[model samples]
Target: MSVIGQAEGIEHGTVRGYKQHRYRQIPACDACKKALRDDRAAARRGERPERAKPQRTSRRKAAEELDAATEATPVLLPVPPPPQLPDRPEIGVPIEGADLEIGDVIVFLGNHHRIDRFEPYTGSLRAELGEGTRVACAGTWGMTVGPTSTVRILPRPRRDAR
Candidate 1:
């Protein structure tokens, strides 16, 4: 495919031509993309290589030019400070793993379990779901290994996650 297309005399090898292609819903060619990239690279370096250059400059002349350029800079206005945002309350409440009280509903095995008997010292709890089904947890955590826990001692912790 021709990278520099000449369908409508749009000059498709340049950055301006690339924008024209986009405005007309046409995919820009590789040459146009390369041209755009080169243009941006030149802009970052503050240079226009395609434009005519003075060809030579002495150190003193270059210093004078630099001083002139600095003097030509526009005056900057003072910017106001950012607006202060209103203070917000913290999101979800933090759950203490072993500090859960009896009759407190807890989520275990993705099910709601109301604690029946809880041992504060052992961090153990017995939760009952219904009339007969009961879950005796050895620790406050649903799954524990090396002081790491997978569950929080809260009623429907999984629900809050969703």
Candidate 2:
């Protein structure tokens, strides 16, 4: 009975067209109904192939129930934080002409920073991590633990080409 299936100039009289109408939950037009009746009559007289019955399902009801359940119960899952980069076991190695230094790349507290130089102080080493941040301590040689952060350097890291 919907006006959508009753376009003035559109043809909806074929079996294919009627099936499409049923798919959209639209009522078949009078022309399509007459075509179906004539086809059945011909099949009874053995004049044509029998028409196939359209498949029926309760998908609409299930979809409606799903919509209602989602509306009644909101999703309360927490969003996980972004992944952090794993720390490097050996930040640097001792080159023939250089003191123990850091690698080209260093990951700290889930962040990466470049280290081109070293600033040593007594029992520990200091590396100016970024613009205004000066974090002290290198691998296992000694670690500097403060109220804010901790840095450690491995005593004997393999000499690698960094």
Candidate 3:
């Protein structure tokens, strides 16, 4: 008998089969075998048979509605500019506990000079105020000019000076 008729034959009690039989060993018809295989594949892939998705509105109609809604909305005003920053001081420099370097400009005795060199061993700095005037200022340690001296290192002159 054909395999397709085996299930019918078993159901009708007309076929004599072995007493010990594995269900997997039983041959199935084409359609039943296809369904069993599909179910097993879905299980192995960690998925279930999905149902058909619901229909959605047309893309053109949805886009037209969105455009109409946006056009009907009011136009928003531009954001205001941020607050202005405060102006900084013209002249201010800290002299205490500072490290002096070559090319540093210092205001001393109503004159400005570029530092030519620093003598740490003698605690002095050599600078040129202008032509024909190069002097050694004492107490250069920690960049302190002197107890009475108001000398300070200027980062740069005022922009108006240029």
Selected candidate, larger lDDT, 1 vs 3: 1
Q: What ranking emerges by lDDT with the best candidate at the front?
A: 1, 2, 3
Can you write out model 1's per-residue Cα lDDT over 118-141, one digit (the tens) per residue? 332332332322222223344454
- Collision pairs in model 2: 138-152, 138-153, 139-152, 139-153, 139-154, 140-153, 140-154
Better of 1 and 2 by lDDT: 1
Q: lDDT of all predictions, in order shown?
A: 0.47, 0.44, 0.41
Local lDDT at 61 for model 1: 92
lDDT per residue (tens digit) for residues 1-162 in model 2: 754433343447765455444444344566775676676688699987434445554999879877987888775444442343332335421121122245533434544344545544333333432222332334333222232232322323325525
Give the number of the best model, judged by TM-score. 1
Per-residue accuracy of model 3 over 36-101 as CA lDDT, tens digit each: 446658869978534445557699988987798788876554444334333222232323213344
In candidate 3, position 135 carries an lDDT of 33
Clashing residue pair totals per candidate (backbone < 3 A): 0, 7, 0
Model 3: residues with Cα > 4 Å off, grouped in runs: 1-92, 121-151, 156-162
Q: In lDDT terms, which candidate is top?
A: 1
Off by over 4 Å in 1: 1-7, 48-162
Query: Which is better, 1 or 2, measured by TM-score?
Result: 1
Residue pairs with colliding backbones in model 1 are none
